[model samples]
Target: MRAPARLREDGPLRATLVAIGLAVFGIAATQFTTLPAFLLEPALQGTPTDASIEARTMLLILNFLGFVLAGGIYLSATDRGWSYVDLRMPTRRGWLYVAAGVVGSVVFFVAVSALVQLLSLPTAESQVMDFVGDDQTMVLVMILIVFFFNAPAEEFLFRNVIQKRLYSAFSRMQAVVAASAVFALVHFPVYTAYADSLGATAISLSVVFGGSIIFGYLYAKTDNLVVPTVAHAAFNAFQFGLLYVALEYDIEEAQPAPSHAIDVVLALC
Candidate 1:
């Protein structure tokens, strides 16, 4: 499906504005999902850490709905229905791309971890790690959540919606880069909660940015949202699964602690 005529006619400046507006709306909608978590705060209080599996699960479900709402509202307003985004069952070749995307993303993550360790770069653990915190049950549940909701929702909004929209004016590479920047920046608040300093936060954001770039490139190449969605989901599921193993076996070196060198590799595995 072609983009709406209005969007097709947009110049770079106008397209960039629209992409930014959509990103802002998407971020706000997802943030609104946290309101229900406040109600759970009473139950969540006095936890060893601030994270609660129940609250986190609820929030992720709400976030999935919120992202869908945001994307739907924007598409409706723009007269571009859901079909405008390239979401479909993957073709055989598309499945190959999906496999490549997943493996490439994992390799990229490992490379970044090694780089960080070799340089002793300041970094922060993802806030999601806090939600799992030595709980095998939480890790298992979060693995499902990341696969079914968290990864798909974020990919739908960022890669399918934002990156595709940017294609109206920007080249594929440009759109991918821009969408990735937005994706990374939107997670700044979440990362900051666990980051010790601005440098640490920046490093965390860099990792997100790099990962988003991989997802965006997959979407651009395959022209199918499913390619990136599955890849992203698998990447995230790997992390949660690794965390589960760490908790189950009491693998102290593999726990996602920012101070541990091996944790970085395992965290992204």
Candidate 2:
């Protein structure tokens, strides 16, 4: 803990490269660790159990860990602590920011839905949501895990580490746009893993890119990662909460039950 500050303090290029390099290696480490279940079936090994559920959940956990590892490496290399990435605990006003952000997130969803409809934007269900489906037990556990792990990791890397550095190196708009673009680009794996069409992937990427811009701007304005982190987690949690609500609602009704949340949401269409 007493190591001297050895890395340079102000080089955006170095910071960006270090962050990205660590992220790539971390992802590869996770992918290698979790590839077996996809390649081998339990029945073939006489296990006679569906390991797919565990496998999928592990992937989410591991990916979150990977992003954390990336942040850890960047911090270590930079000889800085969490504050270097604007991860200070929120003040009273910060809490208010978070509360307001939740409302903004709800508005974001509605606005984006309208945008998609207006543009005829291709859309596809996110695969992460599959791991967080209507199983209440699973959903409850994932909410905390995602709030603490995935949302924090992403905000740390994208806003604190990358955008913070960019802010010092360039104008505010350049910093936010560049950092958000990188944030959105890194999500390409989801496209390959889940999207059925190029148009679907494009729209998904565009939405994520736009969301990243919002998060980046939030972090810039508030000077706290917690604000954006909480907002991002809230948005995701609400999305899942909606699914759970619709599912439970239909399960109560005598009408035909939907297989997934989209079916319930798609009634608008």
Compare the candidates by lDDT and give the number of the best one. Answer: 1
Model 1 over residues 1-269: C-alpha lDDT tens digits? 56678767889888777777887787678657656765666443234235566775676577566777899899899888987778789999999999998899889778887888899988876544544566778777767876787777778888888898889888899999999887776666666665788899898788878888988999999989889989988887776666677778888656542212112212221
Candidate 1 regions with alpha-carbon error over 4 angstroms: 1-8, 44-55, 256-269
Score candidate 2 by TM-score against the native.
0.73
Angstrom error of the Cα, residue 193, model 2: value is 5.3
The per-residue C-alpha lDDT of model 1 at residue 251 equals: 86
Q: After best superposition, candidate 1 residue 264: deviation in angstroms?
A: 18
What's each prediction's clash count?
Answer: 0, 0
